[model samples]
Target: MTHTTLVTSIQESTGKTAITLALGLLAQDGDETVGYMKPKGTRLQSNVGKTLDEDPMLAREVLGTDAEMHQMEPVVYSPTFIEQAIRGREDPDELREIVAEQFEALAADTDHMFVEGGGSLTTGGIIELTDDEIAELIDARVVLVATYEQPGDVDDVLAAADRLGDRLDGVVFNLVGEGDHDELENDVVPFLEGRGVPVHGIVPRKQDLAGVTVGDLADELAAEVVTDVPTDEFVERFSVGAMGADEALRHFRRTRDAAVITGGDRSDIHTAALEAPGIKCLILTGGHRPPGAVVGKAADKGVPILLVRTDTLTTVDRAEEVVRSGRTRDAETVEAMRELLADHADVEGLLGH
Candidate 1:
């Protein structure tokens, strides 16, 4: 029998996919044949004529799962899918059938198959399918990933545990801030366990895990990549250089791996950034090219200079998107997540449950 583990969250950005991938990597490392599948893909990308979700391919590369992309993530909802479903043009039952079939195929010859749900428990209820319902369909044990933002957040997990009943396996508290560690260790875990919900792990927040690299920034902003300086260098912070050279220099000095967002014409800020340490790259906004001397200095310092057409504020907002997007594809981040699971997560309980 294939042991199936379903990882879901109350809302998005709770590190569901990261936890799922961590567990899958652990299972594979133990010499177990691990497989992965995401039923309803929200991060859709094209592959031939079909839409492939990012997680399945990511799992295949990281875990060495034999499951192909099409089989693992088969049913990708188009933009108009929900509209069609409500208008009686799309069949919910048919969607469930495809999911069931693909899931079975992925499970064959595998010791453990991880079923990661998108968004939340009530995510796909619009199309008459939810994580709990899918859990029922595949007989998978459910694990909820909760964000440790506030003290009242435990109620969400308790409510889900109440609803999922016997099928609910446990909970993993993710992105626990420094302030919440004591509460998670002394209060939250005890409270949840007292309420009949098992607490498997509490992962502390790491800035590196939340960072986005220069390559991703360029892609996110559609900026022109003018130079190559470790595109993989993670930018943990962002600074807008609208101040004088001395003020901007001081601000840039305090931040590590900071992306200086300024206009292309601001040679003052440009000169200051080139001389600053921990500078990931310089983002010149407003379609104005920096002076040749400034560009030469950046190139000399081996820092990439991305020239974008968007204004300073809009460019900063797009840069913020990269920070919000927690991508686990980076080698550094993968190792960090693996360490978190190794130290905190209950691997034996999660697998043998």
Candidate 2:
């Protein structure tokens, strides 16, 4: 069977999921069938006291696959398991076995599999099994997504490249702060190249990712939206806290066409967000019922409301997916991103193209 795997490493909260999704979209531009996997995940949700390492829904979204979430991300080991394993109650090797099994499954039916790593290069309290181990296990090339602002990020990238040995493909310098393009091309690129690490691509900081459907954001955050506004317009910008009228007004002004995603139960926040001037919409997360008065006020103000049961971070994750995918430019930036990958990537060796 012919298969290619693209593994990405990113620091926590650096838009790794966005990049994974973009790569999946790009790979699909050709005739290639793609799959996705998150090899290491620390967050776990318990179902009937059984812990799952990853949120399967995330894998489904990133991979754009119909395969069951469990099948896509099978090597799940929660922090509890890690702690237990450390105490000798659970076999540490069991997690590795699970990941290997899933990698085998993903490899079986796809032309290319995009494997995403959890957190950054060293996360999950298991310093022993760096992302390098997963890359080695899957026999896949590694693409490092280095967050731009870290002071010693270059060192981290270089070290990761060194550890990947032959498996290291390239590095994508992501999350460039807005208006830092000059420093990136002149300073960052040349420095990395001088050290022999090929700079694959650089993703600019985009504000549009804040524009995501209110309902989708609620779904991820597991929250609820509680207004009559068009769910679509509720896309982008979420702030959690006292949803007072003042805060709502400020957020609406500070963010471009943003929605205040908060809890409906908090009448103060709900009412405040509704009253914000030119507010796009108000999303009530946490699945709480919005007070009737708040609902009426929202209607009067012509703002929409949605309800979901997820926390703040999950809400951000879903909203991010919407924003990142909503306004993609197949322009010079994307082409530049691809060129960097092709230049450093061992494409001929990995995919035989």
Residue 72 local lDDT, model 1: 80
Per-residue lDDT of candidate 1, residues 46-107 (tens digit): 77877777777777777777777778876676576667777888788988888899999889
Please give the distance, in angstroms, between residue 38's alpha carbon in candidate 2 and its true position after superposition. 2.3
The Cα local distance difference test for each model comes to: 0.82, 0.62
Error of 1 at 26 (Å): 1.7
Tens digits of per-residue lDDT, candidate 2, 154-198, equal: 677777777677776677766576566677778878988897777
User: Model 1: which residue pairs collide?
Assistant: none
Q: What is the lDDT of candidate 1?
A: 0.82
Count of clashes in candidate 2: 26
Task: Please report the TM-score between candidate 1 and the true structure.
Answer: 0.79
- What are the root-mean-square deviations of the candidates from the true structure over C-alphas? 4.3, 6.9
| Model 1 residue 222 lDDT score | 90
